[model samples]
Target: MTLTEKTAYLKGLMEGLNTDDKVIAAIADILSDMAAEIAEIKDDVDELSEVVDVIDEDLGEVEKDIYEIDDDDDHCCCCDDDDDEDYDDYDDDEDEYEEIFDDEDLYEVTCPTCGDTICLNAAMIEDGSINCPNCNELLEFDLDDIEDEDESESEE
Candidate 1:
């Protein structure tokens, strides 16, 4: 039986006892009040559960829209490689990007503090120094030595 029904039955039993004990009557009244409060709390919880389910469904739809999720597709949007044509297009774009940077000399420098390799260009090297992005340590380049070597090489 439901808690409310059980409490009501107990209350009816207590009333039928016709007891002179004030304590028994008071306990019965407390039990009845507790049952009512519990029923109200259960109803609130049920309503909240329904609201949460609706929100969850809404969130799932939003995620599908944002991520371009397809019901039949198993792969994630970013990592999907099912289309060979699209993959070839991506490769062409990458090759174009490489061609753009081919004329410019790229230098790789390893940070002494963090051991992270950083790629730089001639202009950045001419600036003499840059902070290591990983550790924020000041790294100075000896441009004079590099210039002297280049000059010597040209002379040779």
Candidate 2:
């Protein structure tokens, strides 16, 4: 069942109790748990909506013709590309960028520190380091940072 429906069901259960105060408090506690699950589901949906999939190969069709904010970058998943190309993979002379990484979504990130633009799928950023071709500057977080972030999030 959908998270919203489940939350509503829990709310109804909490509302229907004509029993002792203890039972009512127990139902309230369960409702809180259900509400937290619903919030997580909402977050999952919001994150998934940011995913840019050009083709649903399983469905044999492309529903949303994915386009980029600029012509110079396409969020391609392949990370084995030459490190020295300096955005030959892009369309034209483009300078600015930001990380559009979703966990399963492809992201095209430009390194402000080294002036190197990178096309990272979920896999490359999973490690989180795209070294610059010229100065070899390590731009953005490495895998360690990613793990740290996960740990902090779990603690929350």
Candidate 3:
């Protein structure tokens, strides 16, 4: 029925032939056919090996997407703020704004209250305040008025 089955059948028949020239010739023909079939199988195996290698490479990239995180916070915002530590976005306006140390690699933000140091991003700091998600203390303070004064009033 299949190539493998046919090859096996021909091999058995070739071994059991009697002492006749016709039987010998038939055996030779079947051996040649079997050799060609074996070659085709080897080629198919090589192709499958290449396909498996590509699938393995794709799986490695998928692992990175699953493990990567946006924030690398260890203890989180609800922790204590270091009074002596300065924020990443510090200004020289006041003692509260002064940086505790010079660490450029790490981000820093000052808690509006107690002048505590908070290490985080400006975007995460949110609304001019370092509201410590760790201590539940509003670390940063924001005084915002989105309404702008009319230009016509200034001209008058």
Q: Relative to the unseen true structure, what is the C-alpha lDDT of residue 93 in candidate 3, on a scale of 0 to 100?
A: 50
**Greater-TM-score candidate between 2 and 3:** 3
Q: State candidate 1's TM-score.
A: 0.52
Per-residue lDDT value at 113 in model 1: 83
TM-score of each: 0.52, 0.24, 0.31
Per-model C-alpha lDDT, please? 0.88, 0.63, 0.61
Better of 1 and 3 by lDDT: 1
Number of the top lDDT candidate: 1
Off by over 4 Å in 1: 76-81, 84-120, 124-156
Of candidates 2 and 1, the better by lDDT:
1
Q: Deviation in angstroms for 60 in model 2? A: 47
Ordering by TM-score? 1, 3, 2
- RMSD (Cα, Å) for all candidates, in order, is 6.3, 24.2, 17.2
If ranked by lDDT, best first, what sequence of candidates would result? Answer: 1, 2, 3
TM-score of 2: 0.24
lDDT of each residue in 26-84, candidate 2, tens digit only: 76677768778878988898777655342245233333335223345464647554644
Higher-ranked by TM-score: 1 or 2: 1
